[model samples]
Target: MSATVFAGALFAGPVLAGPLRANANDVPLADIPALVLPALGETLIMVGIVMAVVVVVGVPLGAIIHNLARDGLFPNPSLHSALSWIVSVGRSLPFLILMVAIIPFTRLLTGTNIGIAAAVVPMSVAGIAFFTRIVENSLRSVPPSLVKVAKSSGGSSFQIIRTAQLGEAVPSLIGGLTINTIAMIEYSAIAGTIGAGGIGYVAITYGYQRFDNQVMLATIIILVALVAAVQVIGDALVRLTTPHSSTASDRRFARKVARLDIESANAASPV
Candidate 1:
């Protein structure tokens, strides 16, 4: 009776082990090239599109907001107040919640709620709002006296913004852009919840659902590398644009312009 029981137990062990081996991801290492390349491409595409839209729309929107506020070149308190409120509301929402809330809008724009195109809508919207605030803050950091110098020289509002404000703020703006771009990459991953095909989607479908830890780890590593590359490039650009002597000269010029602007304002006032 003992011998017979041992034989039955030995047979059952192999049978149970067979299913566990089969359940593990086959060719997980081999599948890396096939899966990661395409998913990485999709991620880049989504982030690229969202960033393009954000730069084109958000930069101008921020500039307009900056120029319209009090102490700006052309203050319009009511308009600035309204636009500021809109931006604040946009910036306050969490990205995931924003995605769900904009489903109807996304569907309207893309005609489908489950692909890269649809994902771009919410991503771009969020990117725009976030980057606009970054740009507004960057522009505000430019010495106010720069605007005064441009005005005293008879420079138009547009010229002052283009040549004085944005020109001076380029280094800070590039830093903001780098931060915004990284944020969009994160948003792209969240977008994968809706079947937007990117590394995130791959991680979810294959890594989490199928229990493939290899794939999940690979995706994470690739994302880290990509963000690091962006940061390096962004820092390089900022360094290239900001020369020390120019920055010092700018500070000096701003101080002189500020004193002159104050004197001119005092003389022009009706006491």
Candidate 2:
């Protein structure tokens, strides 16, 4: 009975869904190229704007938080605690909830609370808090020894952070950014619910709503391709920026090679 019901549900999904089958034939092959291409461009623009806003705001905010010394400049435990709490609250909110909750702000910015412009508000807000944490974590991971060395060389706190800490933290920060960008792509789908047009919107409007399985399948393929492309680019960037092997590993390999050479010399000399 359960198997029969499951099969029925799967078979009935397209029939029961209205928009899923709407005038798909009305969408010309030529029009598809025009529609999808422009949508892709809009999505990229939205992502770029959000990424820039988040980075600009998040990086400085994180730097300030990470640099909070026990007795240094701008030392305010209460402020730090408050900002951290705010970030926590933002992260805890589901993306859809955040989108709906910020509708008024979206209206204020975009005048209609719909489309790529409206999507930017919630997406960028969520991104700022999310990326701030990543930035903070990466900055914190910078070696204390490097900072100490900089100080011993008569470097100021600002100089140490600018020259040593940030330089060392770049690879990790880039990695975090890469991951965050990918996540934002996935999150952008929720923006479609509020009438933001992306491939996800295309999928729903012309596929799920219209019962066009081909369109849904095509959208999924495009999304998967986008994700794979991001991963490949991120990996290439990490390899280009980061050290591949540890100094200790290199030292160990050198020692093993030297020992083998010495053994070979002894064997030839005596045996």
Q: TM-score, each model? A: 0.81, 0.78
Please report the candidate that would top TM-score against the real structure.
1
Query: Which candidate gets the maximum lDDT versus the true structure?
Result: 1
Model 1: clashing residue pairs?
none
Find the 10 residues in a row with the least total lDDT in model 1.
Answer: 18-27
The deviation in Å at residue 92 for candidate 2 is 0.7
Candidate 2's error at 227, in angstroms? 1.1
Can you list the residue pairs that collide in candidate 2?
19-209, 19-210, 20-208, 20-209, 20-210, 20-211, 21-210, 21-211, 22-210
For model 1, the stretches where C-alpha displacement exceeds 4 angstroms are: 1-23, 245-271
Tens-digit lDDT string for candidate 1 (53-103) = 999999999999998999887899999999989989889999999999999
Clashes of each: 0, 9
